[model samples]
Target: MAKQQLAVLITLLAFLGPAACQQQGLHICFNGWLKVPPLLSYLLCPPGSRTTNPPPSPSPNPAPPSGAGLSYDYYNNNGSSSYCPSAESLVKDAVKKAIDMDPGVGAGLIRLFFHDCFVRGCDASVLLNTTTSKDSPTDTEREGPPNKNSLRGFEVIDAAKAAIEATCPGTVSCADIVAFAARDASSLLSYGKINMKMPGGRLDGRVSFANETDQLPGPFSSLAQLQSSFREKGLSSDEMVTLSGAHSIGKAHCGFFSDRLPPNPSTMDYAFATELEVKCQGNEANMVHQDYQTAYVLDNKFYQNVRANKVLFDSDDVLKTVREVKQNAEYPEIWERKFEKAMENLGRIVDVKSRREGEIRETCWRVNGAGY
Candidate 1:
């Protein structure tokens, strides 16, 4: 293992230059890639090749996992079992292109992954489409109130699925594709700061119900409600706070937080609310970002935004009261490490599929045609 690590470090140095490596042995970690300790070269990935940008390498005393789950490694877990090794790359490329055109898509994919996993596990049941023919298509998760029009980036997922299907037809699951796309978005949005190696092997689920989306937490949810919802899913308060940091790249529809508008101090900053009122004036459907600082970057800035009462949702503002959550606002690195683990936990809420219940759907928006 030492030899292999040395070889990898040599390769990294060759690319990073000896001065950068020898002068600062730790330079490799912060050279705009996710950092690994002393010699975890395998974890080092190129910016274009990965989904999230990473910071400095792990400390001697690394923080513990946010919740129990598999170790992080985008390369090893991409096509779990070698089913389609290029699955991760394909999704990453597609997401990169889409996000390049519009950074907002990256945030949308992240939210999509959360909605898919929270309701019915990370089964991609949320991707199932509504009825088409006069046959009255059965209701799917897409129709749920939380999803309906709010969920964006379906086309991005479609493009990725098409790319994967062409190369390794019927091998990669739609569920995994959604996970991969979101994973890539993290890297791109963070500009290579968060590189989460997602564990694949998920199987696309056939079932989806509009009503099931109620399982998802709401923007108006109180802290107790948020804690209860996350706890039900095996996520801790710390993990909840870490995941909420995703707001750094996220936006909300006017209706989602309009209730907190001016003259109605709903724990929101009066000035921030007024600013939103102006932007949203006469446009009921306008969208707003919570992280006014770096709306497109994925980091801990949202915690700070929460501190200033500049956030859009009650769910976000309520977090400011938590001492630990507030602390995360002060230290970006501390929250980022936890974010990686929390994301892995969210993706693995359900185990890999079985032939009886799961299959690699040919497309993401619908189940396979005809009889099994």
Candidate 2:
């Protein structure tokens, strides 16, 4: 590993401890790949890839899987009144305050939750309940259940609750707790000036999706597939790309798009595909997926790579309409503005009605692990 990367990895280990680092693999837990470290998370990524943080390591860690599961642990775990959010009126008040303070989570994760609920039916199972131990292939590929990294949103919310609980214990609802947490996390990224609305009264739904394995987007989607997927979830074509900006902070495992790279090239742009292959192959699997922290910086680099035709997926390339414009004199300007607007708008889809039909899972795994 590069000296700088090694330093970052070591620093993260010191910070998050060996136990937390052990449950590193989000996809495959193979050997040789670097364990997902807290600091150098971006090392495994192909600079511009966008599906997951790190890939599976050759010798994956042995930490207990992370994520929620069906069991009513969230709303009913600690104690109904203690863990649940406050009454609907209090939730509304808290949400109103939260949006102004942090809009990213309020708009992003909360909006994501709403979108998931509307399409597949309300079920927080769309949010990961816990780290799973089953094979990925076993999933139905339907909507909900395995939201992939969407569950990470819970991590951000947990942090927010740490602070909120200090001020108002048992009074805030878990649903509002997440809403506020999302807002705060967004403020951390947007400098707290973005326009956000907090929809309150999202009482925690105690039900999770029966198929919680699908619902999440992947790295290999075609532009059309992505458009259709997003549209199905109530998002527009423009919003799909905008939400992708969320990639500005996340990472993807190389395996997610290894095909997009050279040697095993798919239908991706040539230059981009070649570069991605080189980057993916060059890194040691152990060190690649082992790094997950560096994946969250929002810079112009991701967009530029897409412009260079070096992006990993067809979905990413579809946003490159700027390169396809032949005669329109206003294309570049319009594209730039639209891209920014979409991103901003993505952060603004907040409202109380957002939680119409969803229910939080007691356990994230399966509603009933038996035959149901």
Candidate 3:
């Protein structure tokens, strides 16, 4: 009887031990699997079952796709960096020659630069860099932002570049090209030096700004508003009036200032306001598009126009309110000196990186996706 009882006890121990081992083995196996969950599996699986290890996230995303319609490869593609000074002079001369042949860009490009610099020194920061902000529009085709009626300036630059390339290839930096273009372009009217300092290597901006539209002085703004806007950019009242030299080339659509008519009219010079009302026919469609002349000529005319109450924009005409009487023939003479000095000062604004502070974007309306 004792032997039989001992045998049964050993058999029972063997059966119970195997069953406990099996249960613990399953728990250990599950724990190991939980330690390495696959990415998608972790997301899809219930809280308890997913493995922890995600296959090394596919090597971080490759660079953004080109032809994304969002980027402009100004420096790396389409042209070389600025050439030697001899080459630069060639480029500058070439651009001048082309502008001599063409109607638009040379004058427009110079005027655009002057417009930007005069307000805040020669800091091309005024040019939009859409690369990071994602604020620029796309340019997959010719229908890009430059074609927009609002961004006519980009079209002007494009024309100038095409003209320059035709005459001087790979000889100049776009920055220098633009600077010279501005000087020569402005010189077209007055036959006088623009009194410009070449801030070479000003990389064109990657994008145009829709937001800046609101910030830019409009055809109509209260004197106070105009002063505030100009002041924000470190310009004074006289300087604000002087900067209107931009009007020398650009055309104003009649509709741009139609609101200044009778009933709800914003205050403007009587003679100037009356002429616009008559010419615009209270409809923007009737306004004329006028070509801009040289800065020296442009500045002198703006002062004279304001004096005559022939200013076009509301803000322009209102210049008389502050020191209208002070702006006589003497004002124009003084204006020329100040204007030239301002132009020189404007081109000197630079950035810490020394990368021209911006890029000369192929598409002015958009930025390169690589955040160029």
Judging by lDDT against the true structure, name the best candidate: 1
Judged by lDDT against the true structure, how good is candidate 2?
A: 0.40
Whole-model Cα lDDT of every candidate shown, in order: 0.71, 0.40, 0.45
TM-scores across all candidates? 0.75, 0.49, 0.57
The TM-score between candidate 3 and the true structure equals 0.57
The lowest-lDDT stretch of 10 consecutive residues in candidate 1 is: 47-56
* lDDT by residue (tens digit), candidate 3, 217-284: 44544565555545544455555666565465545666655655552334455654666677777675
The C-alpha RMSD of each candidate to the native structure, in angstroms, is: 20.5, 15.2, 24.5
Deviation in Å, model 3, residue 109 alpha carbon: 2.8
Pitting candidate 2 against candidate 3, the one with the higher lDDT is 3
Can you write out model 1's per-residue Cα lDDT over 1-372, one digit (the tens) per residue?
Answer: 698897786676556643443332133322211223333433342322222122223332233323223233433554455356677888989899999899998999999999888866788888888523243347677876677778899999999889887887877788788888888898888877787768866777767767556567677655755665676666777788889999998677887777667636657778777889998884758988758889889988888888777888767878888877778888888887888778877887773442247777887877776322
TM-score order, best first, reads 1, 3, 2
What C-alpha lDDT, on a 0 to 100 scale, does residue 114 get in candidate 2?
Answer: 39
Q: What is the lDDT of residue 53 in candidate 1?
A: 22
Return the top candidate by TM-score: 1
Residue lDDT tens for model 2, 1-372: 898997886666455543343443333211112234323433333222323223222332222111122222233334554355333234334444544464333444544443434333333334434323244233322223234333334444444445455555534445544444444444444343332444333444333332332234445444544554445444565556554544444334565555444633334556545555566775523112111232333333455555555554445556667333221123434443444444333323322332343333233333323233
Error of 2 at 315 (Å): 2.3
